[model samples]
Target: MCSVPLPRRALAGLALAAAAPRLTRAAAAATSLRSTEWEMRTPAGIRHRIQLGWPDALPPAGGYPAMLLLDGQTTYPMAQAVAQPPSGQEPPRDLEAALLVGLTYPEDAFDSGLGVDSRTRDYTLPGPSAPPGAGGVEAFLDFIENHLLPELASRFPLNPDRLALFGHSYGGLCALHAFFTRPALFGTTIAASPSIWWQQGVLLKEEQRFVAALPPGTSRRHLLITVGAREQRSEAELAAMEPRRRERAQSSNMVGRAAAMAERLAGLGAGAPQLEFVSFAGEDHGSVISPAMRRALRFALGR
Candidate 1:
C-alpha cells in the first residue's frame, strides 16, 4: 500500500500535544506527594505545623529512632526520602525504621524577622538579651517536652533514647543551644552550618561557660557539625570585621569556630558528646543541606 506523509511541522505539533497531558500528570503526582502536612497544638494554645514521614510498615521489634527536623516546609521531604529504605529493597533485618518529624510555619508567617523570633523564642535559655516579650523557649520546650513527646510516643513506637535533633542555619543554632542548655533534650544533634555568629558570638561564649561550670560526666550528648567548602567567605568576613560590625552581622569565622568547638568538646574527654566535623567540597551554603543531611542520618542511625 502506498501512503502519503504529513508535513514535518504538523507531525511534530501532534506529537507534542499527545505527550503534554502525560507530562502534566507526572508533574501533578510529584506535587501531591510533596504536599503532605500536619498541625499540632502547643500547650500554650498555639498551633504549629508538623510534617511526618513513616515507612510503609512498622518495624517488628524495637521502636524506631525519631528525627526532629526544623524548617519542615523546606527540608522535611529531602530528609524523609533519604531516611527511607531503598526502593524494592527490604529494610535491614537488624535495623529499625526511622521517623522524620518536621516543624513548619504558616505560609505567611515566614519572614526574616520571623526566623529570628522563632529561634530566639524557641531555642535559647532564659537570658536578659532575649527580645522584649520574648524568652519563651522554655514554654516552647514545655510543648515539646510535655505534649509532643507523649503524643508521638502514644502514636508510634519510638525510642526515646534514640531521638536526634536536626537543624540548619538558624535552626542549627537552635540545636546547638539546646545541646548545651538542655543537654538531655536529644541523644544526638546534627548542626549543619550552625550560625555560631548569632548574638556576637554569644553562643560561643555560652559554650565556654558550659564547659567551665559543668562537672565531668554530667550529661551525655553527641554533636555533628557540617559545613560547605564555599562557606569560607562568610568566615573571612567574620575575621576581617571589627568587633562592633562583626557582632552586628553575627559574623564569625565558622570554619575556625567549628574546629575549635570540636577540639574543646574533645578536651572534655569521654564525658562530652562525640563531636564530628564534616566538610563537603564544591558545595556552597545553600547547597550543603542534602549532603549534610545524608551524613547526619548515617551518624544518627549508626549505619
Candidate 2:
C-alpha cells in the first residue's frame, strides 16, 4: 500500500528565505493539499526523498500528468502551488491537473546548503579527466528510470505519455544529459538556467549527437530552456563585481549559451522536441526559480 500522507509540520524542513514570501505562502497553502513523502534508497545505497502532491480532484481517464523536479527541497512547494492552486483560488482556465513529484535528499531545506554535496554527486556528468566527485549522473538516471518510476506508478495514476523532468543549475545540466541519452524518458523537459559551461560546455556536443541520431520518424517531444535576464550580468553589475567574479561571469555567458542551444535545437525539424526559450526580465539565478517553474507547468500541460 502507498504510505500515509505526512503531517503539515513535517514540511517545516522545506522553509525558504524572506525574499520568497510568495513561495512561503504557497508552502503554507500546500499543507492542506493531498501530499505524501517517500524515503527510498537507490541501488548504490544512496538514500533519496521523494515528495508528491496531487490535486484534490480525481484523475482523468489516462491519469494525471506527472512532473518530476530535481531540487525538490526548493522547487516542490512552488510546483505544488502551480499544479493545484490554494483553496478558493481559481486555477488558470487552460491549466490541467498534474502530479508534482520532487526528487531530493533527506534532512534538506531550501536554505540549508546541506544538500549541496549530494547534488554535486548526483546532478553532474563529467569525463575521465574531470574533477573527483563527478560523473554519477548515469547511475542517478538509472535509479530514476529503473527504480523510482515504477514505485511512483504503484502509488498513483500517472499519464505515461505526459511525464516531464525539471531542474535548475546543476540539476538543469543533468536534465539535459538525461534527454540526450534517453529521449523517451519524459515527454517534456524544462531546464532552467542550466550550467551549460560545466566541463567546458560538453552538453553542446551532446546536443549535436542527439539531433544527429534522431530518426526521420522520431517521436515528438518538448524542451523549454529558461534563463534569468540578469544571469549574464549587466555592464554596471560586472564592473561592480571583483575582477575574478566578473571574469567568470563574462566567460560563463549563461544567457547567450542557453539561447543558442534553443535556437540550434529548434532546427531539428518535425521529429525532435519543440523548443522554447524564455528569459525572465530582471530576475537573477536565486530569484528565477518561481517564475520559471510557473512557466514550466504551463508548457508541460500544453497551456
Q: What digit string (tens of lDDT, one per residue) describes model 2 on residues 47-90?
A: 88888776655567676678999989899988887677765677
- Regions of model 1 farther than 4 Å from truth: 1-36, 85-96, 111-120, 124-136, 213-220, 234-250
Error of 1 at 257 (Å): 1.5
Clashing pairs in 2: none
Model 2 TM-score, all chains together: 0.83
> lDDT for every model?
0.65, 0.77
Clashes of each: 0, 0
Residue pairs that clash (backbone atoms under 3 angstroms), model 1:
none
Question: How far is each candidate from the true structure, as Cα RMSD in Å?
Answer: 15.1, 8.3
